[model samples]
Target: MQSTNLKFIFDHSAAAPGHQHDARVFSESLLCQRLEDGWRPLPQGVLLGDSGYAMRDFLQTPIPNPQTPAENRYNAAHKRTRSRIECAIGQLKNSWRCLSKLRVKDPAYAAEIIKAVIVLHNRRMDQNPEDLPAPEEEQEDQCPPEEMGTTEARAAGKQKQNELINFFVR
Candidate 1:
């Protein structure tokens, strides 16, 4: 994961193979595990996730069918904010051509290479802050691959999302 400043916050590319589902990989990451264990990374902070991720108290996803202006506004804002990550990824790939096609045969070695590249990417951002790309307009909508399972945690997530919707309209 990356920050709004285009810095790598959590680079768990080694956590799962590239073929794994995005949500599954996220669910298996140590970061998610820590959050599930009631660890708060930041005070009153929430992460914006794409539809592929499950809605959680710490992570917010777009509403599937927005019924009100408030909900629509929330989705629009979410899309805007989430686009930063996408832009960051594009910047990373553009800056480091090697990442475009990894010839590294060993998975472990490739993971190490990715980590090194991410570190270098962050350092480059620090040295040349102006190199960052301007935020782009909303791209294509990311529809959820399947219905996110419903549980008590999901219910809590919905509650958190509603709170955000209210905040937007207010």
Candidate 2:
């Protein structure tokens, strides 16, 4: 890939067309289910993440070697770079009342609208990247991190989360 190429990582919420959306589990592993997708990492890659995408399985599972100090540095940078996606989401939601409103009466129509919006976002970006600004965080939340689940999974997730917390603390 060329150095000029930029990467984008946006969060996805899998709310059934007409169903009410649950923000907490929108992108959770059991709920969102995108880990199995084909996503191979590249040296020049960047990943944008949100509170929902802040899981070991979600970030580490998809990208190669996502559990290391070097990986952590890369992910932090990616997080900053990807902040633009969050802003894009915010802007789109603000601009399109339908996006943030109650789901469309027709599930299929709602799904179609959501897809169309995503496509429009991409097209708009292609036209100009300056339209969306990056997001800024004022404070932190008090979550233990690495959502608790599975024995082996818990160990790994807890260990990684602890490492990150310690890193930032220092």
Candidate 3:
């Protein structure tokens, strides 16, 4: 999901039993693969993701244990920016109670239902955003485990993050 616009760029549904890690699914996604293969250029800005997502040139994840004040500030700013997506998600689930406990018999149908909910949520945000409740404080479980990418990608991601940290610190 795009934080600035609160729009979903892509949505997919897979069997939960096998696809446990979000990074695994995201890494294998066509969009990520295309970007990695240089078939597509990255968008103008960096994307913020939780620890579960590996750091990449286009995606920035938080520093798990920030040692310096600058690093701490960067993590704070990153979290604040990334929280927009979390807010949108909370609103979506709250607006549609059915999403809380999806009792669909088929996984495909469940996917359809989720997509429909997202569409409806977006419409609601567009029409009557004031009515939606504020997003709750993020819970510990929301901070997923970190997943590292390839060595070269990790190095690039670190360099970019360092640049940002320096910018903020300055």
Best by TM-score: 1
Misplaced by over 4 Å in model 3 are 10-21, 39-42, 140-148
Clashing pairs in 2: none
Count residue pairs with overlapping backbones in model 3: 0
Output the number of the lDDT-best candidate.
1
Per-residue lDDT over 1-170 for candidate 1, one digit per residue giving the tens place of the 0 to 100 score = 77778788644656365566667777777887877777986858888887878888888988878999999999999988877777887778778889889866687888888898898989999999687655444454455632444487788888999899999898
Model 2: per-residue Cα lDDT over 1-170, one tens digit each: 11222322334443354443232444443323444243434432323334433444233321234666655674575556554444555655654567777455776677667767766766666888576544334332233333434566535544655554455544
lDDT of 2 at 31: 28
Error of 3 at 108 (Å): 2.2
Give per-residue CA lDDT, model 3, range 58-143, as digits (tens). 77889989999999999999988877877777777777889878876776777778788777877776888788877666553354
Would you list the rank order by lDDT, best first? 1, 3, 2
Question: lDDT scores for all predictions?
Answer: 0.78, 0.47, 0.72
RMSD of each: 2.7, 7.4, 2.8
Q: For candidate 3, what is the TM-score? A: 0.82
Give one clash count per candidate, in the order shown.
0, 0, 0
My TM-score estimates for the predictions, one after another, are 0.87, 0.51, 0.82
Better model by lDDT, 2 or 3?
A: 3
